[model samples]
Target: MIHMAVTPKDRSHIRTYKTAKQAWERLEKLFLGNESIQSSRFEEVNNAANNFVMLEGETAEEVHRRLTALALQLTELGATFADDAWIKRKFFTALLPYEEMKSGARESRELIRLLWPTETLPTDLANLIKWLETAPDRFIDWKESAARAGADMALSFVLSWYDEVNLDQLECRRADVEENLPAENKTARLARACAIADFVDKRVFIEDPNPPSDDEEELEDEEIEMESPPPAVDPAGPPPAGA
Candidate 1:
């Protein structure tokens, strides 16, 4: 089974192990898994680790939950982080990969520096998520600046006059507006936050004010037919049923 489980490239190393247990142990060293886990689970953990990253609109809590789920998967697969700090470090670096997020990613890294003042992101994951959720004030002025730039971008789109001089002046004004803006513009922030949360999520990664409840199942409505009123009883004449 171990022979079949190991990748072709790993065969050379495991072939000489002389026992299935030894071969499995070598396979564990090569990637994340245990003899107990089926070979597919072993491959899954490695793939998950390599692909782990913050999705564009995910909140801090969502990220934490995702990490927890991933950690559990690793445990089930008989793998583990070298240390708690290693998990935290992975959480810190899982920024979304997009041009707009690049600036935010750099800022986030710098903030991690101030929080840890270390070569690696050394803060506990819980503390980091708490700060991410609660740090709205830090983004206020920068958000306003982004709003300014966003306003400029919106106005520029509807321009009937795109003369060289007007364009030049507008460009200069945009530059001024962006001087104090955060790494990303308003539209990017909006995209990051998504519809209902809007800039709030972008400014601070947290649960939405009125997040949808998973427990609230939508009940299907049943259609009811009203019985026709009893044969339109005459106003004056009563029906004879023992009347």
Candidate 2:
């Protein structure tokens, strides 16, 4: 015989309803009743809530199936919460099965490109390489911070794969580390990087407008348009760098 440990709350919540609908109603009420009650023991409360919801639905067999699906979805969410890479990889994984389905990769790639043009391949990959060339070694400098930041190892791994495959570069760079991050994680990091890049590009790098020359006034009168020069790279180039 096996004995299992049960919490007092769990025991108390164990209830039976004559009809499935009644059980569902009770389940909803119980969940709503305790939602504000936060505690470290959240898992226990969640389990009870879920169990009650299952019991209130369909036939026992169907209940089991629904519960299993719910469990799987929760597990995926849990993994994603724990690691950034999981979420990132999950996105790429979702796109994988369709890769062979009659230009599925093309369609997905196009959609993603439109959705996140700045972070899309070729361009993003090129910038990442430039970033890694100088960014500090985050693994050495930010081990604790990275973990606390919820940065996922899987995300790093995915980015690295991108760097390795895309640039065909063997050595790891700061951008390489970024690339090694999973797709989702890379998106976050890249968004940050892009923001910084834009700021630097606009404020620090872009040349100040030239004061209008006496000739310029004459040119303007003549309707001769002058184009501004592109932004300048710093003598040392982009930011100091980061992992």
Candidate 3:
């Protein structure tokens, strides 16, 4: 059963194991390795994170994605510092390529400041990448635009997503609020603020920003179910990986 269950490649490892328990353990070690094995993987990723130096033509967005993915992978292995300052420091260290003391330090500061929005750097990983990818200058424009709308515009940047308010009726309601925001915006940011969260929450909605189309809705309504899981090696044994 074990021989039939695993792929041809994985079968090589399980073939030598005599019992079901032994075969299962081998498979676990191969995929979700034990603590010691995980620690070794963590050390490898940690080294990559620490030794990261920007490639000659690398954009900050690309470098940030790579470094953050590595850092997240490390955190999954074990607990570590995830404070704002700690992450920022690690990110900066990976970004700059120091050539000389004075020049490199100045260039590093300039590059780091490029990631800032208005008076402050972003406080989290997602915001940091967003700031970098959108270009800090654009964030400043968004900030100013929000400010002109109301006094508490900074809260507007607190980062919400449209999926939170993604019902079809809710979407149309949000669009109405945004359209009428100018009227409500004079007194306070309440309506405008609500509208803007859903507006800016859109990562990409240049054309319509409308809800799912009729065809899309029909496809969703008649969604196909996933295939049934493969049977276990034994009734008492766990289901295979594809399940």
Candidate 4:
């Protein structure tokens, strides 16, 4: 059965072992070694998280997708972080120069309110990306607001470093509005917030920000091979004489 299970090329390796146990041990070593190498590869992908930043022309969805891919890779490699909240936090932080939005609410909720205040914010990461992609008008307004407010030195600095909206004391204003809300309205608002959290699993795990196409993958693979060190040659083999 084992012989039948292995590929033809691997059959020779099995035959070289005298007993089934030996063959199994050898196979384990080979596969285990490959897994170790893959773990190192995951570490490389995780290291990439440190370098992630929202590019000038890129949307938040694009950035989220890219970071999601890295996070997924980490998960696949048996590396687990604290929770989805941590993953969401990591991605938010990774969007460097765009400091966390000033809303005391969770980042995802704040993002939802920023992009689509009227609609129900989807709890899933993919859905959120879809939502952002579909709303060009909202994005235009967002960009314009940023540009207009960005002219002020203090606002510009805050927007660039914290990546927060220049709301001009929006938090205080929000408190004032909440304070004036009727008792029934406030209860409804609290219920809505709870529903949103429940709908979105507190926060969704981000996935590949920019999944590569086949052609891109090929190019990346070629680049990786080119960058890799050449294999060591046998010391006892041939030696080149002085030219």
Find the candidate with the highest lDDT and give its number.
Answer: 4
lDDT of 1 by residue, 98-206 (tens): 4346566567767755433434652554655566664475455356545555554445544745434454465555456666777668678567444323323233223
Per-residue CA lDDT of candidate 3, range 100-150, in tens? Answer: 433644554455474342347545546555645656565555565544444
Model 4 ranges with Cα > 4 A deviation: 1-35, 99-243
Candidate 3, superposed: residue stretches over 4 Å from native: 1-31, 98-243
What lDDT score is found at residue 165 in candidate 4? 72
Q: Say which prediction, candidate 1 or candidate 3, comes out ahead on TM-score.
A: 3
lDDT of each: 0.58, 0.44, 0.60, 0.64
Candidate 3 overall lDDT versus native: 0.60
Could you give the C-alpha RMSD of every candidate to the true structure, in order shown? 22.6, 27.1, 27.5, 27.7
Stretches of candidate 2 exceeding 4 Å from the true structure: 1-81, 104-243
Indicate the TM-score of model 4: 0.27
RMSD of 4: 27.7
- The better-scoring model by lDDT among 2 and 3 is 3
lDDT of 2 by residue, 19-74 (tens): 65665554454455553443323565346324444232245456445544444444
lDDT score, residue 175, model 1?
54
Ranking by lDDT: 4, 3, 1, 2
Q: Output the worst ten-in-a-row residue range by lDDT, candidate 3.
A: 201-210
